[model samples]
Target: MPEKVTVSVTDEAVGRIDEVVAALEHGGMHVDQVLRPIGLITGSIDTQRVQALGDVAGVAAVERQRTVQLPPPDSDVQ
Candidate 1:
């Protein structure tokens, strides 16, 4: 599983994320070229800067970290 991260959202940032979602669903994810939401959620950067990108109106998702338990690596399959 991928690590979770938090991203701050502004009114401006979310607009762009919506566009990207649309593109990903139809235009083959081209919106990823300049601004992408993954960077924010992945903790590579802050959401404020994302909003500064202009095209994005606001941020949508901000995943919070959570704890989970599972079998350790190298364990035999059930």
Candidate 2:
């Protein structure tokens, strides 16, 4: 079975992330290996309407996080 997902990104600046590495960029020197990226944001998403999101603009150089399923409270019992 395929996993169901609803992902979307808003073309807006929310905030910047901390940096942890130094690297050269085409434009100039940047904190290349940024632990996180700048201007990461989120908004409403509909997996069914993915086709309509082709024109959505995503932030630059930021990595998007994926949904993860955590074990139930009692799962620590194994």
Model 2 over residues 1-78: C-alpha lDDT tens digits? 222222222324223222111111211222222223443222323334333333333323322236778789978756
> Best by lDDT, which number?
1
Model 1 lDDT tens row, 1-78: 233344444546554655544432242222323335443423322333332233433445544446687877878955
Candidate 2 off by > 4 Å? 1-37, 57-65, 76-78
Give the total clashing residue pairs for model 1. Answer: 13
